[model samples]
Target: MAAGSRRVRAARRRQRRLAKGTHDLTEVQWTALLSAWAGCAYCGAEDPSLQRDCVLPISRGGRYTLDNVVPACRSCNASKCNFEVTGWLRRKQLDEQDFLLRYAEIRATLVTDLDDLDDPRN
Candidate 1:
């Protein structure tokens, strides 16, 4: 594909994601998420430059909310583009169950923290 076409496709994908839902993952939340994970969610690479990747993928109706996003290294993000998480992990010989379990635990903790922040008592 031509460079122009690729840009157009990316733009269209962005529009589609926006239409589907809000990208409400805040910077503070992102920081907490990164700290919780301590590395790439998929490969556990302790790289400083991690990208926010959608668990379900934008093309497949995923949004950038905290529940659907994780920190991924560039290589894993590129390799897993638009592919379902479990299947992609299996193909790469990674532990899908581990990722899922860890993700659930981290998400729960972060959500609880967020809720506490919203509470008047906090």
Candidate 2:
């Protein structure tokens, strides 16, 4: 796709996300997420430049929040563009079950950490 086309698509995606009232994924959360994953969430590639990929996709009303986002290498992120996570994983011959399980565990831990940060005692 042309650069202009990509920019336009990204702008539209941002509009859609705003319409859905999706929460922003903060830098702190993103850092923790990347640290937790430590590689491509799909293929386990230890790429230094990981991108934030939406599991459900913005086209499907997916948010940019922690629950919907994960670290993905550029290749996997581009290949899985706008596709459902499990189906894309299946097509790529990756372990869908493992991804789901790990995602759940990581999300839970991150959420708990966030909650603790919100607590006064913390």
Candidate 3:
């Protein structure tokens, strides 16, 4: 099989898996993943309540793979819609400082809040 065909097949399988809504990641996993990305992969935002964002359009052909996903703020996620990261960033003229700040905060939040995870109210 061609490399392209294999990738398409894998993506299709992934899409079906997602449709079943049986995500395997635990809360800790989600925290770690989101912390790594800091914010949206498109136009960067450093909001604390960033939502999970898909890199590729699921309707077209996107997988839930870690490599193709990131946490995204509401504004950036909406503006990005179904576009690619490069297009979204170019259209918005996204700055690097925002990303840097987000990354730094992401690290700090996780480390500082490590003890809070044990709290039932959290």
Candidate 4:
């Protein structure tokens, strides 16, 4: 298949998977937003229009679990569209290690399985 076609197919699969996982996270997502206690995850804008975002984008093979999601302002979430989390953080001039540390904390909060505690992919 052509590269573009392959990408499109992959995106569709990711979308389907993400949709399945995010169908009922309204309350949990809102709680996450409130817990942010500041602003956008990427830009740190206080009181920006926030939305639930995937740190590891589904297009990049990320799950739609709470641990893989975060609270981001609309602007930051839109800007990070489908990009790998680390690369998007770098583009925004955010510290990668800091972001990873924060992500680890987020994951820890929702982690029930011990194996989920140490995902190197995040």
Q: What is the per-residue lDDT of model 4 for residues 17-59, given as tens digits with 9 covering 90 to 100?
A: 7776554445645565447535676767776567778777766
Best by lDDT: 1
Worst 10 residues of 2 by lDDT: 14-23
Off by over 4 Å in 3: 1-26, 95-122
Ranking by lDDT: 1, 2, 4, 3
Judge candidate 1 at residue 7 and give its lDDT. Answer: 97
Candidate 1, residue 74: the lDDT equals 95
Question: Clashing residue pairs in candidate 3, if any?
Answer: none
Q: Give the TM-score of candidate 4.
A: 0.64
RMSD of every prediction:
1.6, 2.6, 8.6, 8.0
Off by over 4 Å in 4: 1-26, 110-122
Count of clashing residue pairs in every prediction: 0, 0, 0, 0
TM-scores of all predicted structures: 0.91, 0.86, 0.53, 0.64
Deviation from native of the Cα of residue 43 in model 3, angstroms: 4.5
Ranking by TM-score: 1, 2, 4, 3
In angstroms, the error of model 2 at 93 is: 0.2
Choose the strongest candidate by TM-score: 1
lDDT of every predicted structure (CA atoms): 0.94, 0.91, 0.65, 0.70
lDDT of 2 by residue, 1-122 (tens): 69999999999977876687657899999999999999999999999999999998888888889899999999999999889889999998999999999999999999999879879987
